[model samples]
Target: MKTLNDLLQLGDPRLYEVCEPVQENELPMVKEWVADLHNVMEEIRAKYKFGRGIAAPQLGIMKRLIYLNLNTPSGSVPYIIINPVFENLSEELFELWDDCMSFPNLLVKVKRHQSLTIKYLDENWQPKVWKVEGAISELLQHEFDHLEGILCTMRAIDNQSFKWRPTPDSN
Candidate 1:
C-alpha cells in the first residue's frame, strides 16, 4: 500500500518532468499503478482532509495517467484517465483557490476555463470523452496540468495568491 510519503513534493525534479503517454502494451501494468494512486489518495484524504485526484507523475510513475474520485449526490465516482487530451476549452474563465496533492498544505489562486471537453482512455483502454464544467472541469484541468509538468503554484494569479491551509483552530 502506498502512503502520502510516496508522493513527490514541490521542487521535486520528477514532478517538473512531462509524462509519456501510456502505450497499449502497458495496459496490463496500469492496474497496479492505479492501485498505488488510490492508496496514496486515500492516505492524503485521511490526513489532510482534502484530495479529489492524483497524477501518476506525482508518484514517480512518469506516465500520462490520473486517478480521480469525484463526490456526487449519490456517492463517489472513481475515474482512471489515461493519455488525456483536451478536445475543447471554453473561452470563458473562472478563478478558484486550487489545492494540490503534491503540496497539500498550500492553496493557490488560479484561473481556469469554465468548461472543457476531454478525450481519454478508460481503465479498459476504451476511448471516452467527457464534457464537464465547474468543479469537475477544474479538477481535470489540474490533473492534466500535472501530465504537462505544470503545478498549481506555477499557475498562481499573482505572487500574493498563495496561503497556507487553515487549521481547525484557525477556523
Candidate 2:
C-alpha cells in the first residue's frame, strides 16, 4: 500500500455524487485500499495528534467506506466500516467544529446528531452493528457524509464564516 494525499478541495466535482458499490470479488482490493488508508491515517495522527478517523474518499477513492481509530488509554484499534448504513439516528442535533482531510485546513461548524446507530460489514465480512456518541458519533457521521458526497463545509451553520489554515507540514 502507498501513501495517499488528501483529497481535492471543495467544488471539485469528484467531491459530489454517489460512489459506486464495491463488489464481492473486489473485497480484496477494498482491503488493500483500507490498508493504504490506515497507513495514511497513522501518518496524519502522528503529525496532527488529533485526527481519529479518515474515509477512503479522502484518499480519492470514491467508495462507501471509512476507517476510524478512536484513541484509547491502551492504544488505537482500527475500525473499518464498508458500505455502511445509518439507523436509529436521534432527532436531537448538536453542532461540532469539523475538519476534513479532503478539504484540509478548513474548520466548519456543522450540525449533527447526538447519537447514531450504524450497520456495516467488518474486515471478515461479518455484519456488525454499533451505536456511537459524542465525538466518535460525530466522526462517523462526517465520514459517512463523504460516502454520500457531502462535505462538512456544505453544512456549515454560519455559511462562509469559517476559517481555513494551512495544514502543518502540508506538502
Candidate 3:
C-alpha cells in the first residue's frame, strides 16, 4: 500500500504530464490504484489534517482517476471518479485557498467555478453524471486540473497569492 511518502511532490516532471484516460480493459486494475490513492489521502489527512481528494497522477500512476472522500452532514462519502469529463461550468465563480497533497505545506489562492456538471465512470465502470456546487465543485475542479497536467499554483490569482500553511508550532 502506498503512503503519503509515495505522493509525488510539486515540481516532479511526472506531475506535469497529462494523464491518459483509464481504458475499459484497465478497470480490473483500477481498484489497486484507487486503493493506493485512498491510502495516501488518508495518510495525508492524518498527518497534515486536510485532504479531500487525490488524483492518480499524484502517485505517478499517470492515469485519469480521482479518489474523493468528502465529509457530508450525513457521513463521510467516498467516490472513485474515472475519466471524468466536464459537461458544464457555471459562469459564477468563487475563490479559495486551495491546498494539495502534492505540496501539503503551501496554499494557492485561485478562482473556480461555483458549479459544474460532470460525466464519469464510477468504480463499477458504469456511467454517471453529477451536478455539484460549492466545496465539491471546487474540489472536483482541482482534481480534474491534475489530469490536464495543471496545478493550482499555475492558476494563482497573482504572485502574491502563494502562502505557506501555518505549522502547528507556529499556530
What 10-residue stretch in candidate 2 is worst by lDDT? 1-10
Best by lDDT: 3
Model 2, TM vs. native:
0.88
In model 2, which runs have C-alpha deviations exceeding 4 angstroms? 4-6, 165-171
Candidate 3 residue lDDT tens string, 41-118: 889988899999999999999999999999989999999999999977999999999999999999999999999999
lDDT of 1 by residue, 1-171 (tens): 567788999999998889999999999989999999999999988888998999999999999999998888999999999999996799999999999988888999999999999999999999999999999899999999999999999999999999999964675
RMSD of 3: 1.0
118: Cα error in model 2, Å: 0.1
Candidate 2, residue 25: lDDT: 73
Candidate 1: stretches off by over 4 Å:
none
- Span of 10 residues, lowest total lDDT, candidate 1: 162-171
Please provide TM-scores, in order, for all candidate models, with all chains considered together. Answer: 0.97, 0.88, 0.97
Q: What C-alpha lDDT values do all the predictions have?
A: 0.93, 0.80, 0.94
lDDT of 2 by residue, 1-171 (tens): 657355455777878867776666778887788888888877766665557788777777888888897768999788988889999998988987788766555788888999989999877777899998878889999988888888888788976648866567677
